[model samples]
Target: MTSTPDVIRGIVGVYHADGGLRGELAYLIGKARGTAHCGLCDVTHHALGRRREWRELVAALGVPVELVHLNERSPAVRAASEGRTPCVLAVTDAGHRPLLGPDELAEVDGDVARFATALRGAADRAGLRWAPDER
Candidate 1:
């Protein structure tokens, strides 16, 4: 793949858990019990809510980033990321391409700076370019 300016339309991050109130409670309890885990969640959220640095990073990238739970993924995202929760996908005209996997997300260790670096590096390697800084 080769880099093309503005080719990437958006980014989709898939969480390892399900959605809905019940799902949220389940995950919260499971997480506290050291059972459930979602690396992407670690990167984007905290006890209070979404991380400030994460929001800043998303704004700075100028790319629409949608975070979805396992049950909320679109069909294309589901096909591309089945059984691979906690991954990041680069959405383009061609389709959704895997940018970062679970292990890669885990390596960020909930640091927004590290996650940003990893995401940018992965997008570059995947030949995807951010849309002109819309923000």
Candidate 2:
């Protein structure tokens, strides 16, 4: 977890149980449906930074990731994606924006690490912070 206070840019709110991400992140999670398949899926199930790459991402972004299982999501949840699955979204005070789709992440046959790195870059640009557990 980051040594600095959980507040990112002075935005104060509750965090999710997965890590200590801002409460607003939850809304974004709820808006999306369908968890993207990644190398860390089996281990972390529904988290953003379950693996090493993701850890670095969370550390950088300072927020916890909540992955929704698209295959398992009901039609209602699918509405959030508007039929776009396996895409990265950046949530902000204005609204959410699409970063990439599964097609973009799939690098030379499901290179999840490469995809993660790309996501890390995007999150980094968005000022996301990394929040690791007590290690």
Candidate 3:
């Protein structure tokens, strides 16, 4: 069976919003969902682990990592393409915009290096404080 790290290292795709690339990175923050939790303790631990991992990663990058929970019709998507808001450019601004159709969606399953680089760039632009691990 492939471990989560293995799976994250293999992902390669240019996810786009409104037909533009939004950079590439290992999207491994939410892959553990749906797995049966052994018990209440297990579930709590899993959630805590996820939060810790995310915090550590973001801190390492030294940036303000905003988790944008977009609904089906995401305003960020619209703002990015139309240049209506700066928040929307969070993932699509830099030079890493993906090249694809407006409706096409790519998935980055495991490409860790690319994901890290992209994330770093985003963090730099966003003026986030990097953690020790990110250095």
Q: Which has the greatest lDDT?
A: 1
True-vs-predicted CA distance for residue 80, candidate 2, Å: 4.2
TM-score of 2: 0.43
Number of clashing pairs per prediction, in order: 0, 13, 13
Candidate 1 — which residues are off by over 4 angstroms?
Answer: 1-6
In Å, residue 67's CA in model 3 sits off its true spot by 1.1
Number of the top candidate by TM-score?
1
- Choose 2 or 3, whichever is better by TM-score: 2
List the candidate numbers ranked by lDDT, top first: 1, 2, 3
Which 10 residues in a row give candidate 2 its minimum summed lDDT?
9-18
Q: By the lDDT metric, which is better: model 1 or model 2?
A: 1
- Rank ordering of all candidates by TM-score, starting from the highest: 1, 2, 3
Tens digit of lDDT per residue, candidate 2, span 7-117?
222111111122225433543565355332332233233345445544554455544444554444334334445555555555443334445554554441334456556
Residue 9 Cα positional deviation in candidate 3, in Å, after optimal superposition: 28
Alpha-carbon local distance difference test for all models:
0.90, 0.43, 0.29
Least well predicted 10-residue stretch by lDDT in candidate 3: 5-14
**Once model 2 is optimally superposed onto the true structure by TM-score, how far is the C-alpha of residue 66 displaced, in angstroms?**
1.8
Q: Candidate 1: lDDT over CA atoms?
A: 0.90
1-135: candidate 1 lDDT, tens digit per residue:
555543888899999999999999999999999999999999999999999998998888777999999999889999999988889999887889999999999999999999999998998898777777656
